[model samples]
Target: MTDAIKAIILGIIEGLTEFLPVSSTGHLVLAGDLLKFEGDTAVTFKIVIQLGAVLAVLLLYWKKYLHIGVNMLKMDFAKSKGLNAIHMFLAMIPALIVYLFFKDMIKTHLFGPEPVLIGLVAGAILMIFAARSRGTKTADTVDHLNYKQAFGIGLFQCLALWPGFSRSGSTISGGLLLGTSQKAAADFTFLISVPVMFGASLLDLYDSWDLLNSDALTLMLIGFVTSFVVALIEVVTFIKLIKRLRLEWFALYRFVIAALFYVIVIL
Candidate 1:
């Protein structure tokens, strides 16, 4: 396949899986391996394309973000109810701290098929448990989330540092277990992901700036644009369907994917 074709394929995978309770990194790793796209540059490409998904979020939530920006400008934090900047910061802190400390070690040791398989299985179990044990929902909407719940969800997001453990999977499960409604949890997950994914993508792109020549930039841009369009569609569809979908359903899908990947790629 040509580089552009490979880029488009990977971009679709990233877009389709990025917001789901399925691991986009895990899918990219396996797809890249199969396509012979493995390298430092490929890794950077995967991270940077996540900005496409971030842009999709920005597009979808422009009104919310604009409201928050206006509130901040007016110094009227209290007026901007329902998932303001403070909640976003609280939801990001734990994962940010953990990533800063252990990112290199994680990239060195866990960025592999075996580790991703393990994370896939483990995250599935966690999702199953969260789905079954979620009881007596307290926070029915993002507006109802407190600082403690936000921080606790951030702690769960740290699980996603291990590749196949999906960020949406971990955070949504965390939110459910913490008594948030399903829609509320999923909404918050998408909301906080904007800042988290954007910052990470920018940082990775900065570190890999020298690797991007004209050809690489073209491929990356193709992947970026593809990811943006597909993710915009996926996220909008996901939000509509999230209320009816169970975490257990995603867990089952994860188990099937992990088994197939192990047999096809690892075994």
Candidate 2:
């Protein structure tokens, strides 16, 4: 496929799966194989395109995120909301460490098919167990989370770096297991993704260096715009939808996709 079509496909996958825990990177790996997209350009496309989806999550939660910024000036930053943002930053620590240390290996080796397929099946299996919990708590907003809980969730977020183990999926599941209401877990997961993804995209660009050119950069911009707009819609819808829905369907989807990929590629 041409670069434009590749960018569009990458953006759609990034938007849809970025928050779902189904692993957009994993799907993009599969898509790459199917489309016969080879070379580092394909890898760069996949990584840069995610900026779109992360932008979407940021836009949707802009009010909450912005509130923290405005409050920071008032010395009232410690008043609940700022604390939540602090927790998010805390949770980001481990993944940031991992990213700095192993990001190159991740880009070239981890995101490739073999390790990714293993991660997908492993994450799918874990989600099945996580789904069985059907966590029985609820929180309407971020204020309800405790420091310990935030730390725990942050540790879980680190799992997403493994390729098939999605950052949102693993972190949210970790929150649910710790008894945060599903919405809160999902919300925190979404909020946290923006910084983590932004950090990652920047890292990718730093490594991409002279490899990034006008055409690839343009496609990435297109992908980013597309993902950002769609992600905003999905986040708003996700907030409303989570109240009524169970994560079981997503768990099942992961399992089915894992099984299909395992058979096709690994087995």
Candidate 3:
């Protein structure tokens, strides 16, 4: 395939799986292997394309984020008004701590098919149990969650430090286990991902700065724009799916993908 086609295909995969419980990085790695896309530039492309999903979140919830920022400036840090900036920052602390300390270790040791397979299976099981065990009386929205619950979700997000663990999967499952409705859990999960993904992407870009040539930059732009448009659509659809309490389907998907990886790559 042409470079443009390759970029579009990878962008579609990123957009489709980024917010879902499936592992977007795992999928991208596997797809790149199959398609003969490799090296530092490809890695940087994958990381940068995630900006698409982050931008989708920003566009989708600009009003809420803007309000949170304005409130922060006025020192009106009340959860009752909406999701405040302080608590959102608090929710990000655990992942930040983990990343600061062990990011290089993880990248060196676990960014491979075997670890991804393990993470996929483990994350799938967690999602299944969380979905099945959800209580009827739960926090119904992101604004209803206390700082403790948000912190718990952040801790759970640490599970996603592994490539195939799926950050949204870990956080949403954590949310359900902590007595939040599916929609609420999913909402908070997406909201919290904004800063984490951005920081990681920036770091990756800085590390891979030498790999960007004209062709690679063009491929990155194609993937970036494609993922942005596709992620916008997928995020909306995912919200509707969460509202209907249908996250178990993603558990099944993770299981199937994990099994496929074991069969095709590890056998």
Point to the candidate with the largest lDDT. Answer: 1
In candidate 3, how many Å is residue 168 off?
Answer: 1.0
- Using all chains and alpha carbons, the TM-scores for the candidates as numbered come to 0.96, 0.90, 0.93
lDDT of 1 by residue, 101-141 (tens): 78667767877788889999999999999988838898999
lDDT of 3: 0.84
Q: Write the residue-wise lDDT of candidate 2 on 1-267 in tens digits.
A: 687887777777777777776788888887777777767877877888788887777766788887766665565746644245567777788888888898878887886777777777777766666767866664445677777778888888878888888877788678878778777777788777888888988988888878888987888888888777766777676666643466666667877887787778667
lDDT digits (tens) for residues 99-193 of candidate 3: 77897787777767788888888888888888888376358988888777888988998889888889988998888888888888888888887
> Candidates sorted by lDDT, descending order?
1, 3, 2
Each model's Cα RMSD: 1.4, 2.3, 1.8
Residue runs of model 3 more than 4 Å from their true location after superposition: 134-138
The candidate with the higher lDDT, 1 or 3, is 1
